[model samples]
Target: MTQPAFVAPGVVTAFCPKPTSHTGVVVMVAAKGDGVVVLDSGMAEPMPDALGPALELLGATTADVRAVLSTHGHRDHTGGSRALRDASGALTYFSADDEGLAGFAPDVPVTDGDVISSGDLRFEVVTTPGHTAGSVCFYEPTLKLLVAGDGVQGVGSARKLPVYYESGTRYRASLRKLLALEIDTLVVGHPLAWRGANTHVFTGAQCHELLEDSFAAAEAIRAAVAAVGPHPTPHRAALAVLATSPIFDHFDPGDPVEEDTEATLDSELRDLAGTAVR
Candidate 1:
């Protein structure tokens, strides 16, 4: 039962109880009053059992929170959703595409452009399915704030690119969509590879700069895919690019470069499990 870290005036970032899970969601309080809303509930059994302690730390309660706005259906993101809803009497909403991964169905299956509001806080949902089929980001235009789910990833607070997930093409498009938005501060769901137990934050000019670099990486990945003739093994293509391109400023063939490209290589490579690539 750890309290979320204060990010700004009205926002706080919370974490899952487990060590493996870094970030769970962002909490937004009413601009002027007592209303509270959660971005995503961390993955916890019995729904949001840990949320009570977190809310306690924030000096709020399930009664104050009116809704749970989920960014995607990843277990880490949606695991505590059902419990949170039941406890807070909050309406839970997530993208339709992530039904399977989310395990439980949300009260509402929201799509792009949907609006979620609680008291004076308003968030516009932007669906960008790349990290997962139903991945999304929330934009508070008035605040110029972004609650970016797994759709974006990087090594530090300054993200130069979106982490590689399931689909390279879809991931590319999703990142581009996010970068196009006007944002003053960016809050992601989890810490980057280089950041441990620290909430990732990027603001002002740095937001645009890092996103631009990420976009460049996506563009380069697309070009590689095209050159490989459609269905090339993603790893091979990435390795080829790493060897020849400047996607990464430095790559040592002699050492394990896993940390440097954690976004692109970690889960994508490990998920291969025991499959043979003949």
Candidate 2:
């Protein structure tokens, strides 16, 4: 029984079970009716308990849900799709590029420039292939709100290690693309952090600052890859990065290494070699 709260007009935020501020969920209610839209479900089973509370926040119900937009194919984001759809019969959406992820099958395969409408909300999908091949952000121009799942990771989440499976080059480009948007509110899948501040929501200049910080962090990784060269042992290379990169905080070189960190380092190395292109 998670309590959902309004972060912006007509938009409610719910947290997945046992969530931190970094892993909050977003729900959008139609301005003209009871139609509801959920963005990025959750990571585990039984669906997110917050959904019911979110609907109540807007005076809506499961039957009023018209759409469920997944930011990417990551289970933490897409895991609740089937349950949500089963409950509300809402059309599910995710980038067709990510249909290959386990258990992902979007009712509407989304692409860049595609528009999804629910009630008065018209979300223009912006394809951002980085965190995952099909990572995307939904922007509603009228509200100036962008619901970016994992497409933008500042310095990573609570662990403070950014994760990107696809091309790091493309990830940086996606950050640049988001920086160009006219966004008043930015909602992300995790509490991505910058300089130790972490949250899933950003408003006004904080939005641009967060985008800039994310880009800068990605750029730092790129620079590290360039310095370390492409063939170094993955673990050693990651240690070298952790030792020198200011993008990471509260991390020590002696700490046990994370596989995703190593993977990101390898991906960046490939990017530097021009071999990571998707």
Candidate 3:
């Protein structure tokens, strides 16, 4: 399918073939005046059919793409990097801390507090390194939007935390950083925007609360794992604790747990990384 011309100012244009059981692929298109900044190229191999169509929505051909900014080095987020760069001659930007994950060096090595601009739109680089060593969120103060890669998601109050982190503690700290910002819209990586309704702009206090909740969940999972003796069942045990946590309780009932049982846990672990009993 042909991609669409850009729609909505400061809106991220998402593209993916089929939504996965747990996540989805999204490509954020940041309008820089008449130019465009493409954040994340979805999936590496067997490119999703929606990619072309999604780009087309913005009247962007691969050649028109000027820059590719990555949230981190995950395959799903960086999968299309090579293709997009090769096709568009666009420079790719990433945190200097994530040079190894890019599978190539970044042209623009982003640092915390650095401001990136395309046109009238500018994003302040907020380093959030919990989900990955180099994970970062782009805050458009003018837009009041937080482009939080994998640092946050709306999975459920009780869903299992994402794996693939270089430092869980760092990730938690990053969450706190995100919360400190005045944000009403959270444009996440795997999911679309979380806004509207009763979702109020997050204050420093609320951000701190979310970080505390995340830390508590992590601690609960750690305690469960320690008690379970490095077995597969620890995941389920952790999930149970997470489900009961106050954070999870904030959401409505019937939220999905991607890996709810031992069988699914093993599968998810394999998919995320080689089997490890963490």
Candidate 4:
């Protein structure tokens, strides 16, 4: 298909592509002006078929891209980075902590509070680390748009709780930082882009409620693990807990479970806890 036209006046478009076995790849692209900045690049595959069309719509090409900004280092988000860099000769930008995961070291290592500007568009970095150690959210205050990676998904997807939290306490604090922003449009990585979802913006009050719920879910999972006794396999323990989490429950009641789902969940939790321990 011809690249989807730029959805917003200043924003260009492209698809993130399905990567992981679980979810479809999100549509990833850039919003360009004086400089070009790309969001996620999709899987660690070749340049997506839609990439050319999206760039064309912007009156640009991969060569015009100045920098690539990734919310985190997941394979799906960083997969196309190397190819894009080869194509556009653009510098990559990512959280310092995520350098190894994303493959390429960020030429521009973004820190919290860093402001990136391109002509009239400006993006402020918000360090939101619940999903991963270095996950971040890019906010364009003028447009009130938030490019939140996995920290928060679209309306129906479950928020990937920081399985690798350096500090559970700090991760929660970061969520508070996001909730405090004056966000009107939330452009998340997974699922579709959310526009004009103001009424659903989680307010400070609502955030606290969700935070508590998340913690409660975690605690229940933990409790179930404890009850399963010391020798319980991590995979089984996690599955038992996840089976009871309200977040998982919110989805369809009888969806078929992936054969390796429990194992994958265990691996993710281990990774998350390992980060916390370090």
| lDDT winner | 2
> What is the TM-score of each predicted model, taking all chains together?
0.74, 0.88, 0.69, 0.72
Candidate 2 structure quality by residue, lDDT tens digits, 1-278:
14566767888777675343223433322221347888877755647455677777788877777788888887777877888788879888999888887376899999999988866778899999988889999998888989888788776765446655577888989989998899998887766656667667789998998888788777877777776664537556656675677667644566556666777777887766665455
Task: Give the distance in Å from residue 270's predicted Cα in candidate 1 to where it truly belongs.
Answer: 18
- Cα error of candidate 2 at position 84, Å: 1.2
| Lowest summed lDDT window (length 10), candidate 2 | 25-34
TM-score, candidate 3, is 0.69
> Candidate 2: which stretches are off by over 4 Å?
1-3, 18-34, 230-232, 275-278
In TM-score terms, candidate 2 sits at 0.88
Go through the candidates in order and give the C-alpha RMSD of each one to the true structure. Answer: 6.2, 3.3, 6.7, 5.5
> What's the lDDT for residue 205 in model 4?
47
- Please give the distance, in angstroms, between residue 98's alpha carbon in candidate 3 and its true position after superposition: 2.5
Give the candidates in order of TM-score, highest first.
2, 1, 4, 3
Residue ranges of candidate 1 with Cα displaced over 4 Å: 1-3, 17-34, 46-49, 52-54, 155-162, 193-199, 223-237, 243-246, 249-278
The window of 10 residues in a row where model 4 has the poorest summed lDDT is 192-201
lDDT accuracy of residue 190 in candidate 2: 62
Question: Whose TM-score is greatest here?
Answer: 2
Where is model 3 poorest over a 10-residue stretch in terms of lDDT?
192-201
Q: After superposition, how far is residue 55 of candidate 1 from its true place, in Å?
A: 2.5
Clash tally for model 2: 1
Q: What is the C-alpha lDDT of each candidate?
A: 0.64, 0.74, 0.57, 0.62
The superposed Cα distance between candidate 1 and the true structure at residue 168, in angstroms, equals: 2.0
lDDT rank order: 2, 1, 4, 3
